[model samples]
Target: MKYNMLLIIFPLVMVGCSFSTSTESLTDEIITPDIEKIEDVGSEMITHHHMYDNMDRGNHDYVDKTLVIDPNESEIFRGDVVFFINEDGEKDLSRVVALPNETIKISNSQIFINDKKLDTFYGKAHRVGLDKDSYFKMMDKEGNDYDKEVMKKVFDYNLKEKKLAENEYYVISDDWLRGNMKVLNRETVIGKVIGYTK
Candidate 1:
């Protein structure tokens, strides 16, 4: 009877020792995983990340204010933020275009800088009649009269009556690669594109 008890006790002691050794090894491997989990949780607490800390610094708040801009002007500037919607309406980006008192005009699908053609590598085809004066009366190749309905209410002041006011500039889309006929005054400009963030 004593021998049987000894046999059972011996096996139990060996099994207990084995379990302790396995537990110690598991703890050693688990410590690193636990620390990694803590680090992940800490990162999640951040509200946002600073993205512009390493970017180039420059004046990015230029605005053109020569003309009366319509809210539906397809552009908007609220405080330090500017908004521009893509033609397809799929994306909207914040940016400023012109500085105050800068004159701008688009002609022949080309943008003229200070009456001289600009060699900008950016922008799209210029739309005609964006700044046509009241004297501008013509027909398209198809003989359709120049459509002036859209600008009728937007541009209440005619060019003949009032030239670009002081401290004003015109802003247009860069998509006007060739320069759209539309002109924007610095006063009417929303803002320029500085950077983008998600």
Candidate 2:
């Protein structure tokens, strides 16, 4: 019975001893305002927000799994990670690369906003040779399984020039070569990713 009690109490005693090692040491360790910095940066984000952007050989994969999302914060901006659903009611995620009231044009394998050519690596778009312009038109209107109007809008904007509405935001990944970048509605957004776990 004594050996069993020692076995059980050993861990407890060690824990107690460590905590009471010295009042001065405990005070010294607690003096720094590390919690304040933590609070300032907001609580630790644990939600697994969406991840993407890396692509090769006509395929893509999500890059990170530890993304943190701030659902209550809805102020969207360029480069903000936005999560939403598509016309087929499929949940998806992408970054806000262009804002509303902006003109987005893709031509010559490069993206141009408001007639100013984007000079970043993200401007280079790549995708399978698909006639996305007609992909939406081919869908049935009365009994289609996709959002015809929204899909048509996105598809048309991919090949032609488009001016985003006040409630629209353009989203795309770092692999900007794809032709199906989303010009998503503001109401479709779920939240913004603020940070990621280490």
Candidate 3:
């Protein structure tokens, strides 16, 4: 009777172990891809080839870097690098400098948001002051003689205060000297650049 009981109990335990192993493997198989799919949604990898410099050094060279974009973001914050459609109906990228309904002004190569000076690193970093050589070169290119007053005006040019609409954003490239500031509507924004491949 004891041998018969041992045989029944041992088989039952073995069966339980085998069933658990199979269930674990099945669960892994079913859940792993779902997690991967969830992670992949709204994320895309693209090779950026534009000369936009809002997210990089101010060099206006051709780019072939791969950037990871996340289109799932619903809220856009200042200083976020975003991909969007420009007013010219072209895809472009820029950094958000001012949000909706805010007043933005570029005064003497400085940024003012809501009448307050934007005390940020990018705001300070991208302001390229004109050296004498660069100023002379610019004047030469324009077929004009170099003048200190003209050079100062180049650096001191200001954008008049503009208040954005509720669905508008003021975006600028990192190379503030050469980048154009554009007011984009919310519908034109495609996504936020989340990462890049070095």
Candidate 4:
């Protein structure tokens, strides 16, 4: 009787182990492919020119960089680097500064939203105009010293308060000195930058 009982228990234990291993293998196979499919469908890798370089000045000279874009992003928030089609039928990227139906203005080299100072690290650092020496150099380079008054306007550049439409957003390049500001409709925005590849 003892020998018979041992034989039965050994086979039962072996079968249990085999069943557990098979189950784990099946689960891994199902989960791994699903995760891969999600990644492939949810994000895309694209080469983008780093034209809006407000966060860093060194990358302003039109360097082509790889960016991971999430095209399904539905909610766009302030400070998000977004990809959109410009008025000229070109793909472009900019940082969102004002949301829908909000008033935005650049006054005295500062950004104000709804009569309040924009409270972001980049908001305070928005470069507006060149310094006196740099401005003079630019004037000389262009061979137009007579436009000194016109060039001095860069030092205290200001934009009148403009209210956005219900589906419009105020976007600007990271380098404010470039003076690239546009009101983008919601439909024009394609995606937001999720990450970068070196």
How well does candidate 3 match the true structure in TM-score terms? 0.60
TM-score of 2: 0.52
User: What is the per-residue lDDT of model 1 for residues 158-178, given as tens digits with 9 covering 90 to 100?
Assistant: 222113445533344332222
The collision pairs in model 3 are 54-174
Q: Model 2 over residues 70-139: C-alpha lDDT tens digits?
A: 7787577665656676788966666565689998777655566776665543454533222444444445
Structural similarity to truth (TM-score) of each candidate: 0.28, 0.52, 0.60, 0.60
- Provide the lDDT at 181 for model 3: 71
lDDT of each: 0.31, 0.56, 0.63, 0.63
- lDDT accuracy of residue 102 in candidate 2: 92
lDDT comparison, 2 vs 4, better candidate = 4
Regions of model 3 farther than 4 Å from truth: 1-55, 58-62, 124-154
Choose 2 or 4, whichever is better by TM-score.
4
Measured on C-alpha atoms, candidate 3 has an lDDT of: 0.63
**Candidate 3 structure quality by residue, lDDT tens digits, 1-198:** 999999999999998887653221101111110001123423245434454444445232223445556787899988777888777888788778889999887877667787677766445324233343665676678897545574466457688999999999988766555565789889988887765543
Residue 112's lDDT within candidate 3 is 77
